[model samples]
Target: MLGTIIVGVILVIIVALIVRSMVHDKKNGKSFTCGGDCGKCKGHCH
Candidate 1:
């Protein structure tokens, strides 16, 4: 019904946001946990 459509749209938006964020982080050379730099390692060590 209408409610289901709304929920689907919201989920899609949320997923799109998450994907955008992940892509942005990747372009900036960052990891989810290491925050772009793994101190103990060398260059671009994500």
Candidate 2:
């Protein structure tokens, strides 16, 4: 039971960190996609 609680807490922390980072990126006008300047891509996975 203690182990399960610890795992859940860790998972929550990880998710929180990811959410925070995404919010930060959005505020900075950043994209979490390919992270490149290929130009032709234009935000598409193609």
Candidate 3:
């Protein structure tokens, strides 16, 4: 019984970690820096 609870907790934690890293946090990183608009800038300030 106790072991089953521990295993369930571990599985939940593993799933949480997997879900956490599976997607990108759009706000935390740079936006679309693709060279689609190079016509406006001499060179990217990147």
Candidate 4:
């Protein structure tokens, strides 16, 4: 119905925004795998 369509559209928009934010962070050199605990990292975060 109309409600279902609206919800789907909203879900898509939210997902797109999340993806955009992740891309922006990546462009700024943000690391998603580094938990800021370099002591336990596998030395690949850099």
Candidate 5:
């Protein structure tokens, strides 16, 4: 139906935006897996 198509399109757009943001962060040297606590990170971010 029209509603289903609209929902699917919206979901795809949302996923695309998320991926774009992740890529931007990666390009800026951001770590998605790092907890931000270097002491506890145990050199994982290194």
Candidate 6:
């Protein structure tokens, strides 16, 4: 039914976002946390 299709599409989108975020975090050497404070960590990171 239409409802089932909608649910399936949403699930696919969520999975894609998770995969994208993981790759982005790995490339930036950052964990899943985005506290954004950066604080002292910024100096060594940049």
My TM-score estimates for the predictions, one after another, are: 0.73, 0.72, 0.50, 0.71, 0.75, 0.61
> Residue 38's C-alpha lDDT in candidate 4?
49
Candidate 3 vs 6: which has more TM-score: 6
- Give one digit per residue, the lDDT tens place, for model 5 in 1-46: 9999999999999999999988887787766676344567676765
Rank list by lDDT: 1, 5, 4, 2, 6, 3
Could you tell me the TM-score of candidate 5? 0.75
Cα lDDT for residue 4, candidate 3: 100
Candidate 5 clashes: the total is 0
**Every candidate's lDDT:** 0.83, 0.76, 0.59, 0.78, 0.79, 0.73
Lowest summed lDDT window (length 10), candidate 1:
37-46
Determine the backbone clash count of candidate 4. 0
- Give candidates' CA RMSD values in order: 3.2, 3.4, 9.0, 2.5, 2.1, 4.4
Residues 1-46, candidate 1, lDDT per residue (tens digit)?
9999999999999999999999999888888656677884455564
- Candidate 6, TM-score vs. the true structure? 0.61
Summarize candidate 4's per-residue lDDT along 1-46 as a digit string, tens digits. 9999999999999999988987887787766666434456767767
lDDT of 2: 0.76
- Cα displacement (Å) at residue 13, model 5: 0.5
Error of 3 at 11 (Å): 0.2
> What does candidate 3's lDDT look like per residue over 1-46, in tens digits?
9999999999999999865654343344422453335445544624
User: Relative to the unseen true structure, what is the C-alpha lDDT of residue 17 in candidate 3, on a scale of 0 to 100?
Assistant: 80
RMSD, candidate 2, Å: 3.4
Evaluation by lDDT, superior candidate among 1 and 3: 1
Error of 1 at 10 (Å): 0.2
Worst lDDT run of 10 residues, candidate 4, spans 30-39
Give the Å shift of residue 14 in candidate 2.
Answer: 0.4
User: Against the true structure, whose lDDT is highest?
Assistant: 1
Of candidate 3, the 10-residue stretch with the lowest lDDT total is 23-32
lDDT of 2 by residue, 1-46 (tens): 9999999999999999999998887677666674434364675733
